[model samples]
Target chain A: MPNEAVQYLLTSQRDDGGWGPYPTLPSRTESTALAALALRLAADVEVGARASATSGARWLTETQLDSGAWALGDGVPGPNWSTTLATLALTHFEGEDGAAAAGGAWVLGARGQGPNLWSRALGLFLRPSDTVELDPDLKGWPWVQGTASWVEPTSYALLSLKRLRLVGPAADTRAHIDEAERMLLDRQCDDGGWNYGNSRVFGDVLTSYPDTTSLALLALADRRGEPAVTAALEALPGLAADNDSTLAMGLVAVALATLGGDPEPIRARLRNQLSTWDGGDIRGLAWAAIGLLDGSDPLGLLDG
Target chain B: MVSRRRFLQAGAGAVAATSMACRGRPDPWTPEAAKKPANSPVAILGAPDYDETRLVEVVRQGLGICGISARNLRVVLKPNLVEFDPQGVINTHPTLVAAAIEAFRLEGAREVVVAEGSGHRRDSQYLLTASGLQEQLDDMGAHYVDLNHDRVRRTVLKSSFTDLGELYLPETVLDADLFVSMPKLKTHHWAGATLSMKNLFGIVPGAVYGWPKNPLHWAGIDGSIIDINAALSGRRFNIIDGIVGMEGNGPIQGVAKQVGVLVFGEDPVAVDATGARLMSIDPWKLRYLEATDAFLGNVGEDRIEARGESLSSFRANFDVVTAFEETKVEPSTGGAGGPARIDK
Candidate 1:
């Protein structure tokens, strides 16, 4: 994928103080959520670099709805997906109670009542033995073949909640997590994985890839069931390192690190993979850093 | 014993799994790491003679006292192969390696492999070939494997004492029934001293880690030699070629001295400590020794019983190149970076 495209899909702001669609067009939930995240990342980078960190924050604050929810524009704001990202984004502005708590509450609510998004985004928030509450975080979901519900937004929400040690309605939470895990597992093509939207409700059909498998593994690791764990292990080997997306490689490292007992082999693979990266991939680095520091299995436990 | 057969059947793989069970150390796969314990002690020997013909004999006696049989054992002898002036006394001498090889064969060693990993930027094989040990290896029907590129690898290294992550070791050396460390006596800039244990830095792989074969060097923990040796659980031996010593900026570029004393031991640390004492330096101040002492739970003279030559009996000129002062003017070799900025 184009670096610009991934950046656009991930950024939290647009030039006009509005959020953009995942990659291109400006939309309500994604654009707002993305803009919020961009603001936080920008602020962090600037703090370390001693550059301006508030431009992104300013954009986020300007875009927040009166209900303390963030939106792409002035629309009825209740979509929890946008709010979850917004909450996470605002998590950076901890000093501003009005904005920070608004964002945190949205995250907590969505985590408690929203869909499961624990795999791809907001993963840094998760820890072992965590359950979070999430409120519905999006509205007017977009899809190509069918109507959308909690799959996409819920995945992001679950990750957000998992990070903060909050997840709930144990039965429903398990069910949503289970369905996503199964669709991903059951959709494994000949080579042992779903391509695009197989695991993701809005999975990447155009990118039938191991990166998607990588995401599924992260989710499965957190969702945790004997079958899910087993299926994940089976699917892990199917991931090709030379694929279009290295995202899978990193996630595979995480899952293997978690499931495998002797980490020497896996650690070797991780070092080999990490050293090869161009070092500009912040998202990839985030996961790589976690793998290096701590993973589903605390990395310190293994000595080769 | 739960079926001696089954316990033995669960090979290094089981031990690898156990190594996986500990944490709190650096990932050894990377060049930098935390100091760790070798789990088992290697024999350390002090010598009454630094004579060329008697060097290997003293080493053998040290191993014998420590209960490691040099006879009929597949052995890999590793030495420092850093690129430096031969006359500089900064490098391991060819004759020292030759002595060990001949003695091992005489003792009925099944086969011998003389291996070394030189400067990460230089080929280790070239150093050995240049030092003329390759010829010695061939003469004895022994083989030479450059630790830098050889593909022998196995993982089961778990330091029971530190958080250093699971690490991999060269398969040839790891598989050998007897591993012998043969390092020239020298003082270091980082580890503060180069002894039998410090010489083990050559065991690191440049193929996997690239240049700067040691990760602890990068992590600001230069005493990696101590941790790496401490973590070694395999049956190994230590032999110091102190007949001629290199002091100041050692293990690479240093000044040559006629310390004229050979030290040997079952414990890499103990032998190294004795080497330092013979040089009239305190072993406690050494980076590797300090790190080893912390990991081993104590640092005292009582734990060590010296044999062969007393520390006072051996003396050498330690006025050699300092490790940090040791710099090379790369020869005018041309490559991808164009003409080498060669200094004479």
Candidate 2:
């Protein structure tokens, strides 16, 4: 099944050596990075996987902006959150090249803006019930600059920074990692899973979504022994079942597999679904492959 | 009527006085729009429920009354596919969307694309499937574009509603000859009412704006609404699904209230004003519509000509959250009520 998924990715790769979110759309940074990572992981057993991964890596490297971030691949301007994913992909394929380090530097420099004085004052003036209950001053990664922090991009940044740390010690990486970790922990929902941004909004305790919760848990895999992480992991099967999305199920399987929890049931479900999958969504296929592959921590999400 | 430039200057003056503390306000660039007489017409047609056959007839009739023609034009239907709700109140009903697709195609549209960038969720496939739109699209063989990841072109904001000078909006929307906003008529906790104009927020690419569109949230919801509508003025039309609406705490998390009507118009402001009126909300109380009334379109009852059914026939008071209590319209006494000029 993993081989078939890899074949789909290889067939779907554009002439520019990247993959798109869907087969018909132009290649994007996030989809390309995920596909490249999955391909590299399968390079050992799958034929032609290593060369395809290199081509994808080459596209990523060549398209790297002067600021060290990759613009969103479809001509949208960036230095956006996709930089984190590109960094992780580059680090995995090329082992800490200039492209990876520059991505780290850009990520470190890119922080979600803290609340302005006016907003902060407004927050102070408003009742707690009227506002989201999280520290706006604690900066995490935003999808783009000059906006508030969100969960998924922040998780990707933490993962990228962790991988970059192994190349050599950058003085600022640890602090960024620590702050991002705090940010993720701070935004965890009441139900033990994670939301896209805040756990609460305007007094409502928002529920968690499977994809976001899985990504956050994967990024926090090293802290698996903690109560919060363990509780979140324990809640995975339910979340996966409830969501039952290709991306959600794939991510949950990867998260569970990375944390030493049995992902067999979820994997079984994904395998069943993938049997009739159209291979249209490259990102979902890549994640499915990474989750269904016979290995723990195939993308080194846990190793970092 | 104030021009968009004059409105901007006044707003800039307000900003200056407040030491850069004011939110983005209206623009003053379109003199043509300002000079145009406020004869905006909105059609309110009754639709009892989600029967696609009946909805198609009602929608086609509404389109006819509104003088809309789809001859060889590329149409993009931007619906409120915000999130999944089991009770089916959060999003525009898929049956209504299917009806619109059929209506436009019957009107000779060359292409009709259903597009949405969901605010809360990033995975649009899950949203499409959960919202029952995937099956609908497949059955109809219609095209669906996830505007979140669509190719974008950087567009300058026509009005300064947000600090974001320009936004990377999806080309699918920008390229459409007739860009229709198909939104569920619902009460928004922040905006007081979510209708056609508010639904334009989904056109902003998530690739650029992020999930939930926090950038617009930061910029001021009312101002961003005005800005987005102003930028895409001439190409826009709206058909709101008011047959079933969410009344409390929505855009998401609200109780379903069946309003039994479909709203249609070319002027988004007028359409929304009619929508608010049907919901028993005073459009004048909504800041976005008020600001928009200045240059965008008519919000006054006397200024707009109602087509099809009378406003009183479908009017019902929708429940709103605590913050928007003042927005509810007081029930009329024995008076000269209803749209000033009702068309047969």
lDDT of each: 0.47, 0.81
* DockQ per candidate, 2 decimals: 0.01, 0.45
Q: How well is candidate 1 docked (DockQ)?
A: 0.01
- Model 1 agreement with the true structure over B1-344: per-residue lDDT tens digits: 11111211222123433444353344222222222234333333444343547766765565566666667889888877675354737666776777788777778888878877664323233344456666666666676766654443444434322223544456667777888888888876445567777787777654333234423343223324544675565777777777667766455445667766666656666667666665555555443454454443222445566555445445433443232222211122100021111211
**Candidate 1 Cα deviation (angstroms), residue B139:** 2.0
Residue-wise C-alpha lDDT for candidate 2, range B318-337, written one tens digit per residue: 88887778777664521123
Error of 1 at A80 (Å): 42
Models 1 onward score TM values of 0.43, 0.93
Q: What share of the true interface contacts does candidate 2 keep?
A: 0.34
